[model samples]
Target chain A: MESIGIVNYWIVIALMMIALYIVISANNLIKKIIGLNIFQSSVFILYISIGKVGGGTAPILLKEPAVYSNPLPHVLILTAIVVGVATTALGLALIVRIRSAFGTIDDQDVQQDIERN
Target chain B: MIAIELVVNFTLLGFLLVTALYISQTNRLFRAVMLFGIYSLLTASLFVALDAVDVAFTEAAVGTCIATILMLSALSLTGSRKEVRFRRKNATFAVCVSIALGVALAIGIMDMPQFADPNAPANLHVAPYYLQDSYSEIGIPNVVTSVLASYRGYDTLGEVVVIFTAGIGVIALLTARTSKPKED
Candidate 1:
């Protein structure tokens, strides 16, 4: 039961590590960006999980008394999600520029090109 | 009810783990991108289950809709359908480092508050105040909206600036000339 309670965190940690491995090991720039998005989403999940309270509903008010989950983390993650998409857009744009400038998106290929030049 | 919730949580998390694993292994960039959309959808559903309706909605919209579109557009622009397959000399090293860090973090998690403990410090600090007073002070039924738009207006402003900067940066990077002028 105790393990079940924190299973989400464990799974999130695994996801994070997988993403980290992808980002570090993958030579493709675009794959690295995908890895980065996964990493960011995992962090978002962690924050939302932290804010969850057992038996609590969404943080909306009602005339009747009700328990609401913590709203602060939700608010923080809302901004973060938007910022995350913005970052993705920026990253993809940079990739497009790199593809055009270097004629290849593979990290090693670009490195070889530089070395040859 | 608790048992049902536990089952659902476990199933969703299991699916998430599988998707992450597939995304890490696939070399086809297009397939990877599509799978990432599925991954984001699953995450949004998990957010809904976690009582984060607003965050869930945003994740569905931005993560699934906007981010996917942006990635697809970038893919078409780059014109690369497959990742270049090469012998990864450092793959073993990276796996070891990730496993080591993950173990360290998991050990750290044992000291943290138990999940869903209402008395957890995160729940105690400023959250209760926002949850209780947002309605009375801001006249909004949604505590998250009131807190985001009213109480933490400055933070929202900063977010807007960050987004604006990102937009400008994307435009600048995408529109810049990549080739030098040819001499006649």
Candidate 2:
């Protein structure tokens, strides 16, 4: 039961490792971006998971008394999600430019092309 | 009830792990993007399970919808399918680094508070104050909205500026090629 209680954190860590693996192993620039997205999203989960209280409800007030989960993490993650969107958009835009410039999105090909140039 | 919760949590984690593995293994860019969208959707559901409705909403919107659309558009321009490479050394290095890092992280997590411990440091901090006073101070039902729009207004404004800057950067990058032809 103790392990079960902290299972959330363990899973979050596993997801992070998978994301890192994808980022490091994949050659496609877009795949790297996807891996990065996975990494960021998993971090988001980790933060939100830590903020949970055993019996907390969502952080919305009502007439009846209720336990609420931490609002701070939710607020922070909202800002992060927005920034993530912008960053991803910009990244994809840059990838488009890279494709146009090098004719391939593979890291090795692009590296060799740069060396030849 | 605890049993049910544990079951659901583990199931979601299992699905997330599988989806992530699929996304990494699929060399077809379009399939990978679709799987990433699925991953985001599952993550959003997990956020809901963790009682993060606002974060879940944002994840569904930005993580799944907007990010997927952006990646697909980029794929249209860049083309699908990854270039297969037989870089054994790089693969081995990446595997080693990822395993080392994963093990270190797992070991570190052993000291962390349980998933939903009410007495955890994170729950004992300013969060208690926010939960107690947000309604009276801001008169908003959603504590997250109040904090984001009022207490952290300046930060939100900065984020807006960031989005604006990114939009401008994307526009500039996309349009630069048109200007090159004219210059020639």
Candidate 3:
């Protein structure tokens, strides 16, 4: 039962690893940004998973007494999700700048252009 | 009852894993971006299953909606429709590093309190207070809003500033002249 309970964590970890691999290995700037978004989303899942309670409902008040999942993580992640999008937008903006400057977005191509200059 | 919940959780998580793998392996930038949107939708669904409705709502809006739109716009601006198909010579090194870190993290996870355990330290520290008192103190039906808007107002303010700064940064970066330098 304990192991079953942590299955989400295992999956989150796997997702994180896959995203990390993409970020590290992918040469395309846009693909790397996509990988970073995946990594961020997986981390959000891990936090929400930690906040889950077996018999809990959403963290909304009710007339009748009820268990609620931890709301703190939800609040934190609410901020994080918005911030993640902002970061993504900024990253993509930089990618656009890079594309214009170098005429290519591939990591190796950009590097070779730098060396040739 | 628990059986069904577990099944749903497992199935959703399995799909998430597979989608992440697919995103990692695909070389088509557009395909990867589209699949990433699917990934975010699945993640939001998982958040719903975890009883974080507010988080799920935000994830759906920001992740699936805003992020996808931004990525697609970026794709159009950058005009790189396809990724270079060269084999990654360091792929083996990257895999080894990911696996090593993943195993270490898994070992660390073994010591974590069982999921959904009521007495977990994370559940104990200050969460109970917000959960129990936010309704009475803030007069809001949603504990998350009370905590976010009332208890953690400053943090949200800070987040807003960060977002504002990011917006400025994006405007500055995207609007700057990219014309080639003229020889003196």
Alpha-carbon RMSD, each predicted model:
2.3, 2.7, 2.1
lDDT of 2 by residue, B21-128 (tens): 888777678888999999999989988887899899989998999999999999888776554454567767878888998899988888898888888899898988
Error of 3 at B181 (Å): 9.8
Q: Tens digits of per-residue lDDT for model 3 on B1-184?
A: 6567677788899999999999888889899989999999999998988999999899998899999999999989978776646456757777987898799989989988898888899999999999888877999999999999999999999999999999999999989988762222
Q: State the TM-score of the second chain for every model.
A: 0.93, 0.90, 0.94
Model 3, A1-117: lDDT tens per residue? 355767788888998899889888888889889989999999999999899888788989899999888999999999999999999999999999988888888888889888877
Better of 1 and 2 by lDDT: 1
Per-prediction DockQ comes to 0.66, 0.64, 0.70
Runs of candidate 1 with Cα error greater than 4 angstroms are A1-3, B180-184
Full-model lDDT, candidate 2: 0.86
Lowest-scoring 10 consecutive residues by lDDT in candidate 3 chain B? B175-184
Clashing pairs in 2: none
Candidate 3, which CAPRI tier? medium
> Using alpha carbons, what is the TM-score of model 2?
0.94
Ranking of all candidate structures by their DockQ, best first: 3, 1, 2
